[model samples]
Target: MRPETKEITTESLGVLETAALLRELTAGLIASSDFDAALAQLARTSRDAIPGVSWCGVTVLRAGEPASVATSDVHRSDLDRLQYGADGPAMTAIRQREMILAEDLRRETRWPRWTRRALALGVHGVLSAPVDIDDQVIGSINLYSGRPGVLTASRQLTAMLLAEHAGLLLAAVRDRARQSELAGELDETLAGGEVIGQAIGVIMTQRRCSAQDALQVLRSASAALSLPLREVSERLVGSAARPRG
Candidate 1:
């Protein structure tokens, strides 16, 4: 049978259910520290949160090429990899930016090789929901079931909702990580400035010279030692702390 592709509508989901999904996705973000962790959590969440989904995998465009980011179960990694480097539902969903469903892999005509192997792995049905990660990147949430007809329309709607929330949560996680990295850089810069200041103070006391002259001397020493100014400054500060025995 041919795979079904269509636009997802929210009419199948209730307000409280949607709210609960948002809460679950937010929890996934809070419980994660990086992109990979967040994606792994998302895969697990989708597998458990959506009814009839036995396995879940997340695939995203990395450097303009699709890469499998996470799978709900470690055993599903091989199954997910089967879709990569070949034409399959996940790629179709991502490329078309729509949901793709194969109600029965046995009768599925498209991607015969993939469906055949998927059946060997005990997957009888599949659902792929596209997620917009950012303006530049897109992804898909892939769900697999052990029996046919398990991936119903209502379940597809739920998976779609999960994908929407996951996109937002992942973007937040990425931004927060960027902010933390910048903060660490700022802290290092401030600490380095303090060391340079202390080194200049030591040079001023020893030679009775201006701060600018001390800095120039430090730079000259850095050149002679073939080391960075910051390293030279730290070494100078360390040596000045030792007693002149």
Candidate 2:
């Protein structure tokens, strides 16, 4: 049988108010240039706009390590340390790539190390969601509360929505990094085009073809084989050095 679940409804804000808040949050995120600044803004927004959440923070998985990126609470440093040590609810959610909640950390046994430490720090309840990039889990968003059962079904759904947005922002950052690498590679390739040109010349002579025709042959071969132009040029050069069979 399926586990029982609770339904939570929010009556504090009407549809229009919620829409305005989401617009403002998205605008702030777009205005920020870096992940740190955007996360800081999101933390603050969650604290002010969302109800029953005492602390809001983002944890990023870097090089297979979980680290707290930003938070609205002063104890973020401690939390970061806990997560880095792999002894926190945030890390657990990241490892499992699913939502995790502890209604009362003092009594939970699933994560003994995190539970003991969090209870000592006066964290009674916790909610965490994994941040995903193209279905690959990358990080997490953690919300902590001093009261038990603070993250109801409604609050968890809201947090999931926020986490989804955060995932998009992170994906953009990843895309930019990839684009930068590609740009650098293109610059290097253009700089080394002379070698490719020499290979093309060799092809034109050996194949008895015009210059444009040789270039098209090279391009077509590169596309058909799904190889880089540089690799194709190198192969062509190597073939020219081989003795006739």
Candidate 3:
């Protein structure tokens, strides 16, 4: 479902200013090449754009199994550790794939394991919005406040909008990561081809055989060992390079 953006209210001039800033921030994030830098910018943008939020950060699904706080102004490492330990609201929102509001950590025992720790950190309240892409929950944007009830209805709406922007940026980062992996594979393939070709040349020269004969030798070695043709080629090349003295 699309985030509800109607609850955000401000003076007309303030609203106009915020809209311009949001546009600039979103554009900057979309253009950033570094994922961590982009996430940091997003957190900063949310904290600045939304009123009453003392801290803002993101928690992303790590390997599709657990949530890890990705970025934030608050005690990011501590919160991440709690989520990684499976004892925080970030994980709860990710597991449920829904919005969560903890109005007061001191009184809330819903996440008993995490509440005491958060209260100890002086975080009075928190609002977590799940970051989902195409129905798959990938992460969340958590806004923490030292003051309780800081995430009122209006602020929650603003936070959701910020989270939606973050979700899009995260999806783009994932796509880029996949593309980088494919590019690495392609480079490996090209390097393997070159190595195999040089090995074939070595075989042909050392044995005074034709190209077809050298290929047949490689194929025979592969078949005998049930190894790949490339592996056979590599071995042949290595043997030919050893000193005969």
- TM-score list, all predictions: 0.69, 0.61, 0.66
| Span of 10 residues, lowest total lDDT, candidate 1 | 1-10
Q: Candidate 3: where is the Cα deviation over 4 Å?
A: 1-21, 64-67, 74-76, 82-85, 134-137, 184-193, 196-245
What tens digits encode model 1's per-residue C-alpha lDDT throughout 95-131?
8899999998888988777777788789899999999
Clash tally for model 3? 0
The residue ranges of model 2 lying beyond 4 angstroms of the native Cα positions read: 1-21, 64-68, 82-85, 134-137, 173-245
For TM-score, the strongest prediction is 1
Question: In model 1, which regions exceed 4 Å deviation?
Answer: 1-18, 31-33, 64-68, 82-85, 194-245
- The lDDT for every candidate, in the order shown, is 0.79, 0.71, 0.69
Task: For candidate 2, give the lDDT of residue 71.
Answer: 82
What lDDT score is found at residue 35 in candidate 3? 61
Candidate number of the best lDDT: 1
- Order of the predicted models by lDDT, top scorer first: 1, 2, 3
